[model samples]
Target: MRHRIKNSLALVGSIAVQTFRGDAPAGAAMPRFMERLKAIGRAQDVLTGDGEVSAQLRELVERALEPHRGGDCRRFRIEGPDLRLPEASATALAMALHELATNALKYGALSRDDGCVVVRWWVQADGSGGELRIEWREQGGPPVVSPARRGFGSGLVERALAAELHGRCVIAFEPAGVVCEIRAPLPRVAG
Candidate 1:
């Protein structure tokens, strides 16, 4: 049930981005896509849930779509040893992370001279497999509350990118800042 719900959310989020963001879809009707997104939104109140799972899922979506408020700084950094993984997955993750980081520089925590952003990643062996850990932190910004509505960006980061990598995201809205963390199994790389 939970997997299905999350998948549905991702689907809606993907189509919403395509429908609204000027990205062209091969054959789906735009109106139909919008309806699907609305239905998914109604089916789950992603914002109301609590606990680690809920918090992580919400954070995944939130970080994927960090919005830029006015006067955001434009500086940040990324840290992580390069892992051998599918190029597509790496690209997608990088793209999503870049979007959030860029937005933070423009409007979120990194927008001011006093603000900064830090992104870190690492690979840890777990049991029979390996897991990847990635974190994004916003150092300074105006006070922010969890938004009442989930926008296209959040939906994409949480649902789409996460599904692609078979991972979960965790976002936290803190009194002093914002933080996003993602954990996914490291995929095998073909020779």
Candidate 2:
């Protein structure tokens, strides 16, 4: 019974991670799970410990996602309000940004002394909700080709994040370099 309970708890936690954030496997109902978790957490926090605990939970969630923040990204220039996001969503965003920066730092713009990167974002109203506009531009890098298949970096930039955030990720390869843009939703609670 003890082992069964532990296993059940573990499964619940896993489901929460998969639903509230894109911390689950591919081909799953990514956004549905995230929405479910967000709604459940909001309800849970309403009656139990609220403000402080919610903030702390958000931080803990972000920390848990640190490992996924991998890539060859370099310098970044981010602009806009730091809206409070759920720990899980925040973690996903951080992971996405970190991956971009890491990739730039390694094989992309930051690879050369003459090369550099710019990261920027902004918040805008969208109908009833809001949207976040983010851009990552790489300069002084070699030419690039849109891969026939999504590479690891592409998967994170295009698929994982876009699916979870309900946004669009566009990558443009110019003779000068690569420029990537993302437009994702910013929920009221997240801000």
The candidate maximizing lDDT is: 1
Give lDDT per model, in order: 0.57, 0.54
| Deviating ranges (above 4 Å) for candidate 1 | 1-74
Clashing pairs in 1: 59-171, 68-107, 69-107, 72-111, 73-105, 73-110, 73-111, 73-112
Predictions: Cα RMSD each:
12.4, 9.8
Report the Cα lDDT for candidate 2.
Answer: 0.54
Candidate 1, 1-191: lDDT as tens digits: 57655655565465556656654563554754554444344223332243111323323333333333234324454466755445335434544564565546655776667777777778888895889887888887766567677555565567666887899976676766677778888777654
Q: For model 2, what is the alpha-carbon lDDT of residue 182? A: 83
Residue by residue across 11-35, what tens digits does model 2's lDDT show? 3475555444544465465654454
Q: How many residue pairs clash in each candidate?
A: 8, 16
User: How close to the true structure is residue 102 of candidate 1, measured as C-alpha lDDT?
Assistant: 51
What's each prediction's TM-score?
0.60, 0.57
Relative to the true structure, candidate 2 has a C-alpha RMSD (angstroms) of 9.8
